[model samples]
Target chain A: MSKLLTDLIEALRCLPGVGGKSAQRMAFHLLERERERGLRLASALEQAMQRIGNCTRCRNFSEEPVCSICASSSRDRHVLCVVESPTELAAIEQATGYRGQYFVLLGRLSPLDGLGPEELGLGLLTERLAEGEIEEMIIATNPTVEGEATAHYLAQLARAAGVKPTRLAHGVPLGGELEYVDRGTLAHAFGSRQSL
Target chain B: MSKLLTDLIEALRCLPGVGGKSAQRMAFHLLERERERGLRLASALEQAMQRIGNCTRCRNFSEEPVCSICASSSRDRHVLCVVESPTELAAIEQATGYRGQYFVLLGRLSPLDGLGPEELGLGLLTERLAEGEIEEMIIATNPTVEGEATAHYLAQLARAAGVKPTRLAHGVPLGGELEYVDRGTLAHAFGSRQSL
Candidate 1:
């Protein structure tokens, strides 16, 4: 086997779910049939890795210093939604008629994993809350242990900042991927949110 | 969402089994965590797409004109194995000690899919057979209808070239992936090959 071929296979294993066999299949599929697409993917990867950065205000992925959502004037600044990750933020965007500004936690409060409030950029979030532009802070974190801990911490921040805090309704299934949950369930959960 | 993030997700969909959601997960996985690996994968993909080409003798993927297996002086020249794909060739390499030479068909005789003997590089195989260097030809195409057809055509070429032709034993489960067969079954099948 050629070293380049081996390197391609090894690099493909870097993908989230791709293991050794899958990496080999992907490598062969590209080399044998999808070379053009493979090259396109390479360029796309290069461009994205070099260009994309977190939104300075919301911590969501963005190529700009402040993401479009944070910079948009049409979105409601007073109704803020805080989620553990950008994936959940996207899910909310797709599943509901949400027009609020967002704060992406990037991760939850997992002390064992060394993910504290500081690591998750909670200080930035507190600053956004204290700015007095946000009236209500919706805690849209997943119902996991770490997520709940992060939500409690966020609720404290919201209360300290003199903002009303709320949690998603029980419509969301426990321990489920918030992004993959049914649109109706997620929408309903967002619509009928309860005070924390 | 950033346009580059969307482009990255779209580009990731080129992988065989990846779909919209998997593509999104891969994009986020890379952006949120594995940026370094993502860049490495990009480089690998670029190099492989630009450098890897067909081996002149075997039609297997290779950076060189002749693949390592075909160029190796230690391998026997009197026995040649005909496989439908490099994947199967790799399987044979791992599952059995049978070593001589190989001719990768790249595809089988799927006429509906526009694949024929010419598309499969049978002309090169025929020229190699006509060299009278190979005393036996092993037709290791899969047991699918198209694969069987390709094997028969290869057998005819071997007979015309005055070389005995053989086929794998029944130990290969019909319609199953040749590369994923258990080591015992594949090794036994190769060891107990029968004359076609």
Candidate 2:
């Protein structure tokens, strides 16, 4: 009932899946055992937002201008794996042992939600393709309808720029989030994939 | 990966039903949007711990030495309802038509967990009942086995104190939490009840 308690609970409810009861329980725990914990979380959020900028080359989150993967000479510079968001990129990094560099879209092609090619930074991607160092571009967007549409649009853009484009497999379950899938499944999905 | 971030996530994981994923989500949300919210929760927790003292008469959480309900001139002085926790008391209060005072056990008779009458402040309850203001003591502890045992033990205490001892009706689902039940179901359970 206190203002501080109410605000904490309300703010906790802003998470993707947290509900009112969960928010209350979280607030109670934070209040009871970890005052320092809350401050740490605040710092983490602020630091992550400030220090982790979009990689200039791949658009993945990184403290430097180019992410570690993109900067690494060991990685395959000719192969590029594209993804939607940082969370999704993290999920892919966790699941796959891919040595290729990445390019993050930050969002999918959701015309209905007003997310178009410009919003997804497709112009920059096309410019990168025109540089002609990349031999293959793997569309690792989700298997959702929006992901498919985004991949289709990216394929057209790649063709226009005289670059070869490919997509990740489609055997993943419909409406399934990449984060929920196991590493083995993701790897297997990646291994026996077809070009689209 | 920071120690503060790790500690914050661990602290968030201490809630009743929160898991690693939910805890991470909560930690992120608190960091992103709830800096003020987190501070508020911290303050509330501290304030509740500092200000909420046990009511001398009922052993329930209260800002005053004697809770507002126990000190109220309008509440039924002769009737008292006993519950397992402050959360349960809040639930009953939200049901909103009961004017009787309350006694919170703070815990049930979990012998395996080493909780007994004395440990649960039953001695204070006995001393309070000896004052003779209460004519009836209603056992509203949970319907769990330990709760039943606690109610039975308290009923004996109430009888020995020379007051009418009553128990809230059963059939409100064994092991079901009172706080989660709908208001109508709780009202129905309260209305059509048999003595334990």
Candidate 3:
């Protein structure tokens, strides 16, 4: 193989879930089928790398220090949704019809993985809470152990700061079959059943 | 979303099998964790796009008009292996232990898809056959209907040019169970048994 082609294939392997064969397919597709789009992807990557950075307020991706979510006046400043990543934040925004602001952790607490509250931007979250603008915080982290630990840690901080912090409800998902539902989720759902 | 970040996500979707969610994940990973590698990927894409083009001799990717395979003095110049694409050619080189030069069709004969013998680079194959340097042409296109049709057409061309043409053998793959094998392949394997 040519040096240029080899280098491109090697570099493409850095993408998530991309392996040697997939990288080769991507390289060939770009070179043989979509040269213009390939070049555009290159340019976009370069520009995003140079311009985009962590939003200082919420830690979501942004070109400026403050992201659009943090800067917008239409959103509810009093209600903040805490998420582990920007993708999760976007999912919540779209699926749940959330009109409040968001604080992206970019990761979760995993002691084995050397990730902790500080790494997840808890210090920044505390600072925002100290400003007395946020009335409530929703822990919208995933149900995984790491996400649960991170949410608990954030709740402890919120309690100490006198801010109300609530977790997302855990129950049988809508359209979920009881037979297929796991024991843990079923127990949680039964334990937290709402009274009509 | 920031313009650069949004553009990056949109551009990443051009990769085969990558959807919106995967593209977003890739974009975030590049911006947050792998900026240097992302930049390297961009540079590699740019360099490959600027330097690589189809080899004039065999239609494989090359920086020059003639590819390295076509220019190599060690490979058998009198024998040629014809394949549907460069990926197929590389696969054959790696798996089959074939040391012959290759002619990449780059596409199959699919009239419905507007691909014909001319589009498959058969014109160039014919011109090369007319020169009389090749003694045998191996049809290694594929097992699909289009590939079989292409192989037959190439065989006719080789016969008219007085060059011996052979198709790659069809049989049950090694280590494959007869029960699990498709009926067509099983029949072909039964019919093409070798002498001990």
Candidate 4:
């Protein structure tokens, strides 16, 4: 294979779930079938990187200092949803039609990996909590250890600032089989069962 | 979402098997974490697209008029492999360790899709066979209807030019279960059983 082609394939492996074979397939697909779109993707990536930055207010992606969601007056300023990444923020927005602003941590607290609260923009989160505009902070982080720890840390900060903090409900997912559900999730679901 | 961010996400959807969610994830991954590598990928895509063109000799991708495989003196010029795409050519080269030169059709004979002999580089294939340099032509097109038709068409061309043409042997794959094997493969395996 050509060096340039190989380099492009290798670079595509940096994507979230792309492996060597997938990266190669993506590369060849670009070259053989969608060269024009591939070039457009290149331009889009370049321009997005050159212009888009973390929103100064919410830390989500934005072209300006504040993201559109953060800048919008129609959104609920009193209800803030905290997420570990922009993907999670988007998921919440899409799935639940969440009309509140978001605070993107960009990552969770991983002490072993040297990721601290400072690294996850917890200082900015504290500043937002202290602003007194937010009535509730919903923690929408994943169920992973780091995510849970980060959520706990953020909840303490919110509590200190006299803002109510809430974690997303834990339960067996809709349409999930009991046999296929993991032990931890099943236990959490059992413990959190609702009374009708 | 920012228009730039959304455009990048939309552009990433051009990749094979990438859906909207995956495209968004890829876009976010590029923007949030791998910006440097993302820029490198953009540069690689642009450079590869600007420089890489079809190899005049075999029609595989090349920065020059002829691809490295066709230009190489180390590969066998007498044995040529006909493939439907460059990815298949690469697969054959990797799996079979074949040292023969290749003729990449870039597509198969899909008459229903308006693809014909000219579209498959069969004219170039015939011209190459008529040169008397090729002693054998291996038909390595996929086992689909279009691939079979392409192989049959190329075989007639090679035979007319007095070049021997052979199809890949069909058999039950290595480590495959006989009970799980498809009927067509089982029949082919039985028909082409080898003498130990």
Q: List the residue pairs that clash in candidate 3.
A: none
Tens digits of lDDT, candidate 3, B1-196: 8888889999999999999989988987777789999999989988887889989989998888888888889998899899888888778877887888889999988999999878888889889999888999999988999889988898999999999999988998889999999999999989889999
Please state the error at residue A146 of candidate 4 in Å.
Answer: 3.8
Q: Please tell me which predicted candidate would have the highest DockQ against the true structure.
A: 4
Q: What tens-digit string does per-residue lDDT give for candidate 1 at A7-77?
A: 99999999999999999889988887889999999999999999998998989999999999989989998
TM-score of chain A of each: 0.83, 0.79, 0.91, 0.90
Query: What is the C-alpha lDDT profile of model 1 across B100-135, one tens digit per residue?
Result: 999999999988999987999888888998898999
Over A40-78, each residue of candidate 2 has an lDDT whose tens digit, in order, gives 554454445345456787776566776677778998888
**lDDT on C-alpha atoms for all candidate structures:** 0.90, 0.72, 0.89, 0.89
Arrange candidates by lDDT, descending: 1, 3, 4, 2
Task: Name the regions of candidate 1 deviating beyond 4 angstroms.
Answer: A110-114, A171-196, B110-117, B171-196
| Segments of candidate 2 deviating more than 4 angstroms | A1-11, A21-57, A61-74, A110-118, A123-133, A159-162, A171-196, B1-12, B21-74, B110-118, B172-196
- Model 2 interface DockQ: 0.15
- Model 1: what is its DockQ? 0.71
Among all candidates shown, the one with the greatest TM-score? 4
lDDT of 4 by residue, A81-149 (tens): 999988888888888978888999888999898889898888888888888999999999999987888
Best-first order by DockQ: 4, 1, 3, 2
Q: Cα lDDT for residue A116, model 4? A: 90
Candidate 1 chain A weakest lDDT stretch, 10 residues: A168-177
Each candidate's fnat, listed in order, reads 0.84, 0.11, 0.75, 0.77
Q: At residue A44, give the lDDT of candidate 3.
A: 91
